[model samples]
Target chain A: MRDIHTSAITDAVKKLCMEANWNLEPDMLRAFDRALGRERSAAGKQVLQTLKDNAELARTKRIPYCQDTGMVVCFVELGQDVHVTGGGLYDAINAGVSEGYKEGYLRASIVRSPFDRVNTGDNTPAVIHVDVGPGAEMKIMVMAKGGGCENRSKYKMHTPADAAGAKDFIVECVKTAGPDACPPLVLGVGIGGTFEKSAILSKKALFREIGSPNPDPALDAMEKELLEQANRLGIGPQGYGGDTTAFAIHILTYPCHITSLPVAVTIECHAHRHKEATL
Target chain B: MSVTTANDGIKDLSTPLSDQDVASLKAGDRVRITGVIYTARDAAHGRLAPLIEKGEKLPIDVRGQIIYYTGPSPARPGDVIGAVGPTTASRMDRFTPALLRLGLKGTIGKGYRGDAVKAALREHQAIYFGAIGGAGAVLSRFVKKAEVVAYEDLGTEAIRRLEVENFPAIVLYDCHGGDLYQEGQKVYAREGA
Candidate 1:
């Protein structure tokens, strides 16, 4: 069995949080370059430039990219052969999140209780999802989600006949959201996964690179069709008029109960900051 | 590298901004802004209405000022604030009435406001400028100077006065209640719809 130190996990978590905030990952930058060229509107082009400028400023100044900093979400994959050396593995992960948010100068957006609505001061008790895999290696994925896009998320169960109804609902949601989530945006549509799973899949879909087609032929076609409908809503970049409201629409689907059709749309603004590492 | 100039007062924002000036401004517009603006969002607007009810001393004067609705993150070391970006504007719909009455000239943030806000904008001759929602990096470049003028205890959510030069933004919903999002969509849509 491979011996694992809890402190290692903690330190990695902390450092990862800080690093993610301070720097924009290379892949994200490449995607931005592609977006700059695809955008047709002057305002859309300008927003892309500022986003690039922001990335540069964050790197040179060693500051967090946005003031929201975002709530921490960590996805972990562990090797089944590994055994913990000291302390609880879960606590170690939380510790990493705490230190990273604290030292990194990121915002403390977590709350103690949803009902009370009190800020937890530390962006702690992160949402951690762990999976046990076959090897001796551990992989971690981190994403900082902000309110602008989070607040606009929508999910619904539909009957087969309701498929057409969904187009209008999704379009309306985009229009209502306007430029708030920062356009040109990327839309994540999760189909077939259960209520929460659909939402999770929708978010995970955002990690996919822009312009990458879905592996499933049918799902890819649906994604293209959705993109056509969404941009037609006229919610251009930052809600200012002109084309290029969203950069892409990525969809993930699973088999659902025959009677039900589940769909979840997670809107991601242009900033879309995320990072991952394998240990 | 951008030249720094902060806090020149009302003169800083007097760029003679018009609907046309901002109409074509897509998501990011970086212009050195000089002039006066107001600040009011959800909580402040809520308190202001009650004060207008009781006629007490309001914390801020909204006349001829721009109100930004964001509650930002803490300031990082050697920097002013962390990841500062625009917050949603619909939350303040209830208290917007008092703001128009107080002579507020403009509101800046992401997203559209309710019709009542549009009516208020029309009645008060005000404008709504749309800043990039998550482009805090781009937005912060224009804010050459920032200081917390009120509500220091609120942490990132506290009220502050900022002095900006050539701060970029787009005219989304203007004084005439024109929305750019609608216009842009029409251009990109193909013949089928």
Candidate 2:
């Protein structure tokens, strides 16, 4: 077994947190710039330009790209062939999130109780979804979701009587959402899972990069169709009206109960601030 | 007290902004507004609407002032405010007309307002500027000073008087019923144009 110290893991998590908060991934930059080129609306182009300028100012001044740095979500792939030499691995990851948010000046957006909210101050207790796999190394992906679009995500059970209905429902949600999700959104569609599983899957769908397709042939085309339909809404960037409201639509699907086809849609705004690292 | 950007015909809020000043602005231009701007979101607007319904004196006099729709994060050490960016503007749909009659001059936020607000802006000679949806940190550079002036119980949701400089925003709706968002969308909307 490859023995990893608890402190080493914790240190890695903390550094990853700081880096994710302070830096906008180059891939994200490329996506925005690329989208700008494909964008047809003058208004949409201007919105993208402001985003580009914000990126320049954020990088030069060491400021956060967006104010809502978002709640910390970590997708951890742990290796069964590895052993921890120090404290437990989960503890290390949590500690690192706390330390990173503090040191990086990221806002403490989480609260223990959702109804009667109180600031956690350190942005602690990261929501970690861990999957154990066959390897000697661990991998972590970090995501910070802004609240503007976060409020607009939706999940519903559609009857399997009509196969196309599922896709239709997803398109309506995007149209109603309009420019509210900050436009040029990343659409994560989780299909066929049970209710909560579909929700989680939809969020995980955001982990997919811009313009990537699902592995399934039929579903991949479905993703492409939905992306085109959504852009047609003319809710342009930031809802100002333009040729692009969505840059990509990613679908993640699994088998569900025979009677139900549940679909969840998660919207990621243009400021898609997420990063991945290995331990 | 006059911290400005663009160095143009920027004027104070307490005094009237001329019709010429409002007409000169194009959608994408940037301006740093010095002086007092009030803060309110859905919840705060709810409270203000009822007070206005009774024809009661508002907790704060809002005549000829700019209203920002934001719920900022709590500030940290040596900082005047946190990432205080614009919230979605459509939610204020029902209440803006009454406030417009009460002497409001401008509104700031992300997303577009509906017909009611657009009519109110035209009838009242007011303007609506759309701030960048996600650029809070860069936008924070303009808000040099802030203080809670009302609804202190709302915490970060409280109403504030933010003194800003050269705050950059696109004029989405103007006094003449011109909407940049609508015009821009028509040009870029994905029809077979």
Candidate 3:
């Protein structure tokens, strides 16, 4: 088995965290450019322009794009044939988060516990999702998920026959989210899995590029349709009202039990910060 | 980047907003705010609400001042403030009316306010302003100075009194009960419908 040093993972996570906060991904930038041209509301266009200017300034100034540096979420795909050396995988990941937030001058947004509510100081204890994959390389995908949009994400368990209701539910979710989730959102939809699985799938769907199509033609069609319907609500950019409410909708589906049909919607603001690295 | 100058009929407002200032504002009017403002988010507001209930003097004066619902990032070596943007305003809805009743004239935040908060604004002749939600880096440039005024232990959630110049914002909810979120949706959705 090939051995991967945990320090390498730590270093990668640290750099990725800082990089993700400072720069909006290229795909997101392109999506914003497209939205600027397509937006109908004058205020909406101005909002989009401000966002573009913010991204540019953040990159040049080496500052965070938003004040909420976000809770770090890392998706680690570990190879079955590879072994992690130096320490436990999670410990290394947490160490990376601590260094990243501290050195990068990012905000420490995490609390020790949800109920007790004290700052963790270093933004540690990243939410890590691990999948064992074939091959020898380990891939880590990091996302800085802001709390505003995360608060708006929803999960619902629907009956098997309520397939048509899923679309309506997504539209309603965006409607209710309105300006709170930061309009011109990117929606990640997870369908056909169990409760927790569906939630995870929805988050994973967000890792895809903004304009990329799903591998499954049916899922891609659903994404396109949902996106069109969401923009029709006229929530617009920053909810000032316009035709370009949502930039993109992504769907990831999985097989599930006969009695359960779970759907989860994970909404992301325009500051969609994510980066990936393989080792 | 320099602060965005007020243009296109956008008015310039200063702190210690008067009733006339609140009255002149409308739901959709863009404005550049200058002068002293306070910052408080969920935790600081939680503490302030209880203090107000117990009839204790607050650490910072709320008289006719605007409170920005933001938790800014740590400033770099030479910067006055780090990227600062408005957080979701609805999270602070429950504690808003108490502050409004105490002569808090305005709030700067993102997203929709609840009906209770809107009613309180109308009752108290207050207003709510919306900053560009995710445009923190751009917005932070307008903050000329920032100093922690209270709740230092709360870290980023601590209340900061900021001196700002030409900070851009739009009137989301005016004292007259004009709601920008509702009005904007009505105007744009009609065409689509």
Candidate 4:
């Protein structure tokens, strides 16, 4: 078995946290450029332009993209043939989050409890998900999820007969979210799993690059159709109104029990900040 | 749908806005606000609301003042404020009308304000402005000075008084009941339909 040092994971997580917070991924930047061209409203176009400029300034100046630096969510794919050494994997990850948020000058947005609400100070205890995969390599994907968009995410367990209702459900969610979740959003729709699984799947789908087609042909078509319908809502950039309400809609599906047709929609703002590293 | 740029030419507005100033502004007008504005988010508002109900003096005066719903990152060395941007305004809706009754003239935030908050805006001759969500770094450039005025233990949620210059915002709700978010969406939805 190949041994991977947990310290390396901590260091990598720290750097990834800083990098993801400061820079808008290239795919997101390109999406904004394309949206700017397609947007019809002058005000919407202006908002898009400012978003582009903000991304540039954040990268060059090394400033966190938004004041809500976001709660760190990490997904880890650990190879079955690899053994972690030096320390516990979860502790290392949380340590990295603390170090990164403090050193990078990113906001520490985490609170100790949902109700009692006290700042964790260093953005610790990352929401981590781990899955076992083949080979001897480890893959780490990190997303800085802002509260505005996160608060707007939705999940529903529709009756099996309601399978076709995903489109309406998602559209309704976006319509209800309106300008609040930050329009020109990237929507991640997860289908066919259990309630919680669907929610996780939806969030995982967000890591996919904007405009990339889903591997399953059927799901890919649904993504396209949903994107078109969502944009037709005219929520536009910052919800001011125009043709580009959603930049992309990504759908992921898995087989589920015959009785269940669960779907979850995770809305991500234009700042779709995520970074991945393989070791 | 007719697009009226009612307050378009009035780009820079200072705090302690006059009645005429608030009356003249309409939803969808783009403006760069200047001078002093107070910052308060969930925690600060929670504390301030109780005191307001008790008829006690608030840490900051409410008369003719604008409260920005924000919890900014700590400013780095050599910067006046860290990335400071508006938070979701809906979260503040519960405590808003009380402050409005106390003569709070304006608010800066993102997202839709609930019906009651909009009603309070109309009744009190106040306004709501939307700053570009997620443009915190760029917005910080406009904050010329910032100091934590109260609730120091609240960290980012502390009440801060900021001196700003050319800080941009779009009027989302006006004292006359013009709602930019609803109006803007209707204009496009109809065209698309």
Candidate 5:
């Protein structure tokens, strides 16, 4: 069995938080370049160029790419053979987030209570999801999920009989998001699962690198089709209207109960920042 | 790092904006704003409404000023400000009409405004400018200086007085009832439909 110290987890999480907020991953940077090359509207092209420049500045200066540094969402893959030491896993993660936000000067956007509307000040208690696995290695993926796009995420439970209708409904989410959710968007779609499971799957699907094809050939085709339909809506970049509405569409599916065909779409903005580390 | 400036026919205007400045702009016009503007978002608006309702004095005189619906990230040491960009404007719709009635000239944000806001803008001869939604780092370059003018406890949502130079934005809504989002969509969406 392998023993991992809680301090290490905390350090890793802190570094991931700061890095994700300040840097745009290579996949996202490439996606922007592709969008710039193909975008038909002058406004859309300009917006893409501006966004690329912003990413460079954020990285070099170690400043957040967007003011809404976002509420942290973490996915942890824990191996059964590894023994955690020093503290609870979640406590360590939260401590990391607090330190990262403070030391990095990232915005503390979390509210202690939704109704009271008070800022938590530290940006703590990340939305963490963990899964146990076979090996000794622990993998953690961090996402600074923005409130604007998260507010636009949608889930729908469709009758299994209406399988043909799924694509249209998925595209509808993009239309409804329009300019507000910040396009060009990266759509993470979850198909087939229990209601809550589908939502989680959708959020997890966003971690996939852009320009990468879905492993499942069937889902890959559906993702391509959905992307074409979404862009056709002309929401464009920041809804100024253009041919490039979304950078990519990612779909994750699971076998569900025969009665339900649950689906969820997690809308992500152009500033799609995520990072991962394995220890 | 490059920033948006008044060039290639992009009109440049200063604040506190004048009546002629409002009248000259139309939907879809790209313009750069220079001089002072204020930042306020959901929490700030929530605080503003009650004072306006009770007829109490506001912390800042909002007349002829543009209120950007933004909550900027904290500035790093020695930096003018951090990544500061527009947030969703529609969330501020309820508080907007009151501000416009009080002689607020414009708002900088992203997304569509409600019908009430459209009507209010027409009635008051105000404007709505849409900044690039996620370009906060780039946008911050235009802000020559920033200082929190009120509600320091509110942190990022505090009202900040900003001195900007050639901050670029598109006129999404104008006093003359033109809507850039609608018109722009109609042009590109026709092919898709």
Candidate 6:
């Protein structure tokens, strides 16, 4: 059994929060380059170039890439054999979030309650998901999910016979979101799970490298088709209109009850910031 | 600040835009704004309307000025302000008409305005411009100066007065009811798909 200290977890989360905010991952940079090559609209190309430049500037200046540093979403794969010491897992993660947002000069965008709408000041109490697996290592992945794109995410329950409608539903969601959700989006599609599980799966799918193909051949083909259809909508970069509305579409699936065909689409903006570390 | 003229096809605009100035802009016109604009997002807008309804003085004179829907990150020492990008504008649709009625010349944000906002722009001779939504770090370079003008307790949501130079934007909605989002989509949307 590998004993991991909570302090180490806290330190990793803190560094990941700041690093993810300030720097664009290589996959994201490559995706930007790909979009720049194919974008037909002058305005669209200009927006793409500016985004690339912005990424570089943020890295060099240690500035948060976007003003909305986003609410941190974390996924942890904890091994049964690994024992956590010093504190509760959640306490450590939240401590890291609070410190990272404050120390990194990132925005504290969380509100204490939806109704009262008071600022949380420290951007804490992250949305954390944990799965226990057989191994001696603990893996932590983090995503700074922005509220604007999160607001546009949607889920649908289809009768098993109507599962084919998933593609159309995703396209419709993008159409409805239009320019609001920040086009040049990366769509994470989750298929065939319980309602809530599908939503979580969709978000988790976004942590995959931007241009990488899904491991499953069937899901990989579906992603390609959905991506093509979404881009054809001409939402473009920032929805000013162009050929590159979405850079990629990633799909994940789980076997569901015979009656259920649940699908969820989680829209991610171009500043798709995520990072992971293993302990 | 010296203004860049329209010779290269980009219009140079300044704050406190006059009626004629607003009328001259059209949907899809690229522009670079120079001079001062104010920042306000959800929380700040919530406060402004109550003050207007109460017939109380606002913390800043908003007449003929532009409001950017933004909540910037905290600035590091030696920086004027941190990554200050426009937020989703539709969230402010509820309070927009009121400000437009009070001589608000334009608003800078990302995304579409509602039908009522379009009507208000037409009635008031104002405009709506969109900056690249996620390009906050690049946009911050344009903001040469920034100061919290009101509601400091709201933190980043506080109203800030910013002096910008050559801040790029595209006119999304003009006073004449031209809508860039609609027109651009029509032009670029693949036929028969």
Pick by TM-score: 2 or 6, better one: 6
In candidate 5 the C-alpha lDDT for residue A175 amounts to: 91
Expressed as tens digits, the lDDT of each residue in A134-185 for candidate 2 is 9999888888877778878888899878667888888877776766778878
Q: Please, what are the lDDT tens digits per residue for candidate 5 over residues A99-173?
A: 999999999999998899888998987999999989999999999999999999998889989887777788889
* Candidate 6 per-residue lDDT over residues A1-279, each given as its tens digit: 999999999999999999999998999999999999988898889899999999999999999889999999999999999999999999999999999999999999999898998888989879999999999899999999888888899989988888568678988888888888888898888888798889999999999988898999988988888788888887788989898888888888999998989999998998899999999
| Least well predicted 10-residue stretch by lDDT in candidate 6 chain B | B1-10
lDDT, residue A88, model 5: 96
How far residue A115's Cα lies from its native spot in candidate 4, in Å, is 1.5
Which tens-of-lDDT digit does each residue in A1-279 have in candidate 1? Answer: 898899888888888888878787776677678767776767667777778888888888767777677778787889998887789888988888888888777788777887755667778888887879899878877778776787888888888678877656666667666666777777888877578888788887877777788899987887788777776655566766545667788888778887878888888776676777777
Ten-residue stretch with the least lDDT total in model 3 chain A: A164-173
CAPRI grade of model 6: medium
lDDT of each: 0.70, 0.77, 0.91, 0.88, 0.91, 0.90
lDDT of 5 at A158: 91
DockQ for each of the predicted structures, in order? 0.49, 0.44, 0.67, 0.60, 0.70, 0.76
Q: How should the candidates be ordered by lDDT, best one leading? A: 5, 3, 6, 4, 2, 1
Q: Interface RMSD (Å), each candidate? A: 2.5, 2.9, 1.7, 1.8, 1.3, 1.2
RMSD of 1: 4.7
Residues A26-103 of candidate 3 have per-residue lDDT tens digits of 998998899888787999999998999999999999999999999999999999999999999999999999999999
Q: What is candidate 3's CAPRI-style docking category based on DockQ?
A: medium
Worst 10 residues of 3 chain B by lDDT: B1-10
Q: For model 1, how does the per-residue alpha-carbon lDDT over B79-149 read when each residue is reduced to its tens digit?
A: 65556667788787777767766766667877767889888877776667766777675566566567776
lDDT for position B68 in model 6: 94
Per-residue CA lDDT of model 4 for B1-193, tens digit only, reads 1122335464567777877789878899888787899999999999999899899999999898899999898788998988888899999999999999999999999998899999999998998999999998899999999999999999999999999988899999999999888788776773322
What tier of docking accuracy does candidate 1 attain? Answer: medium
